[model samples]
Target: MSYEKRPDGRNFDELRPIEAKVGVIKNAVGSASFKIGKTWALAAVYGPRELHPKFLQDPAKGRLRCNYNMMPFSGTGDRIRPGGNRRAKEISMVTEKSLMPVLDLKNYPNTVVDVFIELPQTDAGSRCAGICAASMALADAGFVMKDLVSAVAVGRVDDKIVVDLDYQEEAYEDGPVADIPIAMLPRTKEVTLLQMDGEISKEQMAEALELAKKSVDEIYEFQKKALKEKYTGEQNE
Candidate 1:
């Protein structure tokens, strides 16, 4: 998950170009397509619907479950296996955790919200992209939230801290490298997700956290713009 600590010619704080669109799926309550550099994820929201599975249902609040998938052909050179695997499920769980704190679940009693994010293409940091896309999708579904969540990843490259690690930068494996992904509720400035892979000193972790928080503001702006473009465009309004 960590990249080699090399300069790699990328600006330390630069993020990969992101493209986002909402209402991409007409059938879903809400849908979004998101891309960061070469990685792409499509997210759709369905529900506040009746809960079918009895065990997963809650009486006082709407329950939520997430599904994440990476297509077999998402990778280059070789094909990956299709269908839900352990990795996919795990990502779904972490993603659900990150989004859980912000939702006003109790508002929709005896209902369930289903969010699905599919990665048709990926290089790295697809999970982070998923978090961003999922939040927008939920908003599109008209879910109540305290604040929209924004997410990005930070890492140590070439012994220096970097923000938004790209595929090449992330794939680097010369020595010990650390990957730290972060997500926050931007309005409250509260972090909901913080994941670290590999080892780094406390000082390094602090620095990475600082960078992640600052970069989240940029991602948040993109999220707002995407929503506005969908709901506030000339023809949309």
Candidate 2:
């Protein structure tokens, strides 16, 4: 059977409903929660503090480190293993890279900024949600950033090209499935991270990227609004 409509009823170019908020973790220097459909990621930022182990400190600029982890029962598919794993490490690396372009760490030279992302629930798109949450947390930390980073997964499920593939779409077995996760800077529209799993033609890849570009705008707005709400609440108080 051909995949004509999304299992969730979203249009090919539509994204799942999103929610975001900053300063969700009071103890952290910065924190945020980002939710897209059933996936939820919480990020907390700390440091720009002096790096430990003098040999590892960068003289030219600060380093960004990201830690991503999914709770044991977070996924809809199967139980995630507790503690760090290869997948968590890989996503942590990519999340750091994706948020680096917009950060101005030069002033904090010889220091390190750490962002930790934890997914308590997921229905797919966990990495993208982690990136989105981390980006917001960084901004909430009052870091000098050129623009917010936004991300989403766009892919082909069966014969249909769709935006924000959920767990069901990712598991579709009838035909080919390609999952592409992309992160971009809002102001420049520059792609910071792009990764693809499965197979896609060059043309389909191009189209998927364009769709990701358009879709991230919405994610960016939610990020901005969340940051704004934090300050707005402070002012009202």
Candidate 3:
């Protein structure tokens, strides 16, 4: 049974409705919130402050650290245990790497910039949402960056290539499913992160990349708008 119709009825190249905003957290140096469908991620940025361990400090550049956490009750499936898990650790590492290409921390030598991403509710795409939120929060914190990163999941859902896969598509049982999460520099179209969960053909990979690139462009617009609204004093949804 080849998957034909999307569970949510979105077009093959379509994404779930998205919402974004900056300055959502009061005490943090900077913060942003991003929501796509049922998935929601909040990111807070702190520091450019001194790195605590003396040996870990870099004389020429600052370091960026990211922590990703999904609240125990956040998932649409089973309850997640509170505290760090292997999945959280892996996602955290990837999220940091995804946002690193655009940032320039040279001036803030010996310091560390921390980004914390918390998902209060999710319906898949949590890691992508976290990366999106973290990027906005970093920009909001006045970090020097070449560009903002935008991320989304694009892959083969059974027989159809799709963008912004939801929970149902990821768990599609009738046929093969490939869930690929990609992060990119929208202005330059440079892929910073690409991870695939299932097998895909070369032709399918190329097609998926194309879809991801186009989708990130749309996500980029949302990110830019949110940042602009924050500084321009415009209300954002």
Candidate 4:
């Protein structure tokens, strides 16, 4: 089987059209929505506020907490409970790790930064889209950061490496391979989160990382454009 088969006639490194919006929710301190192909996610940021007594608090710097959940009808095949399960918890942790590196946590002491991600549609790259949305929401909240963070997923299908896998592609592909999801600080080109599933040769891994880095660069542009539009609207009023 050839992993290099092109779906939708896009090149190996090509990304689906990305649409992003900020401040979609009126109540949240900040919010953003992002779509990659059919996968859609909304992220909200609320805080640099007091932490609950039961939750762990950071003494030296503000704490970052993340929650990720999918709506019951998000996937095509079946509905899921609209709450955090083990997978959601793990994704949240990974997202937090991905975002922390870019945050200036010490700037806001004795507080907590809460990020929530809601997926209304599921595709292979939803996790990456969620991370991008969260980063934009934090920026909308007026949080200072070193640089914007963005994520993308690269997968091996039929012996070819592809960037931003869709649900259909991910499900049917076969091979000894790797699916690498990565978050990066765009300005500094620093990695904040990295996760991989399956096995690949060293050469293949290197190629995937190269593809991921390029994808991040593309995502950063989309993030900037989305942020500009949000603030532009506010300023015009």
lDDT of 2 by residue, 113-208 (tens): 989999999998999999999989998899998899999999998777789999999988989999999999877789998999999988888889
Residue ranges of candidate 4 with Cα displaced over 4 Å = 234-237
Candidate 4 residue-wise lDDT at 176: 59
Q: How many backbone clashes does candidate 1 have?
A: 4
Tens digits of per-residue lDDT for model 3 on 100-146?
88999999999999999999999989999999999999999998899
Which 10 consecutive positions of candidate 4 have the poorest summed lDDT?
A: 169-178
Q: Per-residue lDDT for 1-237 in model 4, tens only? A: 666566677888999989988989889999999999889999999987898783577778999999999889998887887677999999999999888888888976778889989999987788899999999999999988778899999877767888987877777645555677888887777888888887777787788888888899999999998899875775233
| Residue pairs that clash (backbone atoms under 3 angstroms), model 4 | 2-158, 3-157, 3-158, 3-159, 3-160
> Which candidate tops lDDT?
3
How large is the C-alpha RMSD of every model relative to the true structure? 2.7, 1.6, 1.3, 1.9
TM-score of 1: 0.92
For residue 153, model 4's alpha carbon misses the true position, in angstroms, by 0.2
lDDT of 4 at 37: 89
Q: In terms of lDDT, which candidate is stronger, 2 or 3?
A: 3
Write down the RMSD of candidate 3 (Cα, Å): 1.3
Position 97, candidate 1: lDDT: 95
Candidate 2's TM-score = 0.96
Q: Comparing 2 and 3 by TM-score, which wins?
A: 3
